[model samples]
Target: MGQKRSTFLFSALCFGMAFLYIPMLLLIIYSFNYSKIVPVWGGWSLRWYKVLFESEEVWSALTLSLKIAVMNATFATLLGTLAGLALVRFGRFKGRTLFSGMITAPLVMPEVITGLSLLLLFITMAELIGWPGERGITTITIAHITFSMAYVAVIIQSRLAGMAQDLEEAAMDLGSKPIRVLVDITLPLLAPGMVAGWLLAFTLSLDDLVIASFVTGPGANTLPILIYSRIRLGLRPDINALATIIIVVVTIGVIIAGYLMLRQQKQRERDMQMAAQEVVKLDA
Candidate 1:
């Protein structure tokens, strides 16, 4: 009876999962449907996909989104890693709590509030310095980086907290300069966390729509903004095709990330085993 109950529970969970994804799965399948009406089967064809690629505006928006995502992700990771290192290394120094709160403020703040505040700030800066005349690509990128950096900082801080400081101390004891120790030991150990942070920031920036909408100006529209405008008119097969492409890309990325994480785990296990063997040899 217990086995049967467990099996039933598992089946129910699987059904729930399917139920949640069925609409999305059907939408994707129907992207290739030749009929205008979506959510109903017409006939399968690749014409929509071809049409999507043929549109210069779609390609332009996609390229712009990629560029902004890359820039925001890189900046966020670099700055956030530095912030995390300081938080971990400095510990409970002067105003540590305040500093930490400031670092994570972006994470809890509402997106609309953040966007409005940033828009006002940009306007003030542009008036004072005459740089960014209006909200544009630069503003959008900055806004993305602001929120994305918080995520990176949180991830890096968690990883740094878990890491033992003894390795870094040992390097220093072995006559390595502080910079050398950080470069060779600390940075290497923190690499996985940093990479994870970068990936997270990249995904966030790429997926941002609300924040992007607030900060974007003429000729600076991202793919999400363009797609959203189209959807407001009516559901198009092109939009379905676009959604399907995005789903496929995201799915592949998740799979790749899972594979990389498993590989990293295996590598860490092997290293731990080798270290144990060396310790045993020394003891003998």
Candidate 2:
């Protein structure tokens, strides 16, 4: 009975995987199809892709989206790293808990509410200070950073909490000041966490749609906004092609990252073994 149940569970998991992937697979297959509606399997052609490239509007949107993603990720990572350091390493003060909560509030708040609130804030600021007179690329970047920073802060705070302070202490003992110790020890140790936070921020900024839609003005639509507009019009084969390209790019990146990580781990292990051998030879 247990074996039968296990087999049933395995089959169920396989079915679940298929259910999740089949739509994506069909979309990819139909991207090459010459038919308007998908899954009809007309003769394959690269016409849709050609049309996608020929459209200057799509390229403009894509370029703008990439620019936003890069800028937002850089700003968000810097802000989040500082916030995470203060939250995890700085002295606890009055409203420490409140500050932490406020920093992370964007994460839990619905996108609509967040966007609306940011829009209102921007309007008020513009009215008072005559800055950011209208919603556009700047507003979208601000909105994305608001949420992306929260995510980065959370990841970095966790990493900081797990990190040992011994290295910094040792550096201090060797005549380094606090800032110097941080630069030499803490930042080096936090390199992986920083990379992770930056990547997370970049992904969130790139994928944002709902908030971007609300905050974006007439002429500053990102790729996601453009894709959504197209989706509302109709499910085009070009979208499927775009999605497939994204999937392939992401897959390749992950594979390369994994390979590099494994290589680094092996290198570290080899160094440790060589050090141990040296110590053993000295003892003999």
Candidate 3:
């Protein structure tokens, strides 16, 4: 029975992995096909890559997406961190429930609804304040920030919840002002969570399509939007090449992050061992 169960689990794992990765592998392989038609396999060549690199539209869209993602991530992280701190650190203030609900509402909201609401808000703002006369990078970035911050806030909240308050209380007891303790103790401990939140926010912003589509105006296409439009026209080799490039970039990022995390874990283990040794020596 145990052997059969193990075999079934192993087979399930393999099947799941293949289900998720086989499509990506095929896409990467097809990206090298020389033919313009995606379905037809021509001899392996870098023709599409060359074409992709030459396309000014692709480059412009990529540049704009990166800029928006960066701006959204930074602003989202800042705002989310503040909201998380308030929710967790500020003791039972009036309207705390309403505030927390508003911060997290985006998480459960439908993309279409969120996009429509943001579009309406932008139009209303334009009519009232006469700012953001046209919806483009600024409007898209704002839209991304609105939803991305919810994910960041959730991450920050979970991190803060798991963290012990002993260090912060001790800092405050040792003649440290509230601001000083927060800056010295709380923020330092929250650094990893903040970095994670920022990365998540960046990825969310970059991957956004619906919200960006609703908020963006003429000549302001994001990479996802461009790819989608191209796909609609028909699958092109250049789209495959673009996707392959994105896969490579994302793989490299994942590998680097894994290496850093493993190194940090090893360093933490070594510190714990050294502390144990010192304690034993003191006892002896």
> TM-scores for all candidates?
0.91, 0.93, 0.97
Using TM-score as the measure, the top candidate is 3
Per residue, candidate 1 scores C-alpha lDDT tens digits across 1-284 of: 99999999999999999999998988888899988777667788988999999999999999999999999999999999989999998767898888899999999999999988888888888999996886778999999999999999999999999999999899999999989998999899999899889989998988888889888888888999999998999889988999999999989989997998899999999999999999999999
In candidate 1, stretches whose alpha carbon ends up further than 4 angstroms from where it belongs are 1-4, 267-284
Q: Give the Cα-based TM-score of candidate 3 against the true structure.
A: 0.97
lDDT of 2 by residue, 205-281 (tens): 88999899888998998999999999998788887777777778988999999999999999999999999999999
The residue-by-residue lDDT of candidate 3 on 66-180, one tens digit each, is 9999999999999999999999988899999999999999999999999999999999999999878999999999999999999999999999989888888999999899899
Residue pairs with backbone atoms closer than 3 Å in model 3 (clashes): none
Candidate 2 ranges with C-alpha deviation above 4 Å: 273-284
Report how far off residue 282 is in candidate 1 (Å).
Answer: 12
Give candidate 1's TM-score.
0.91
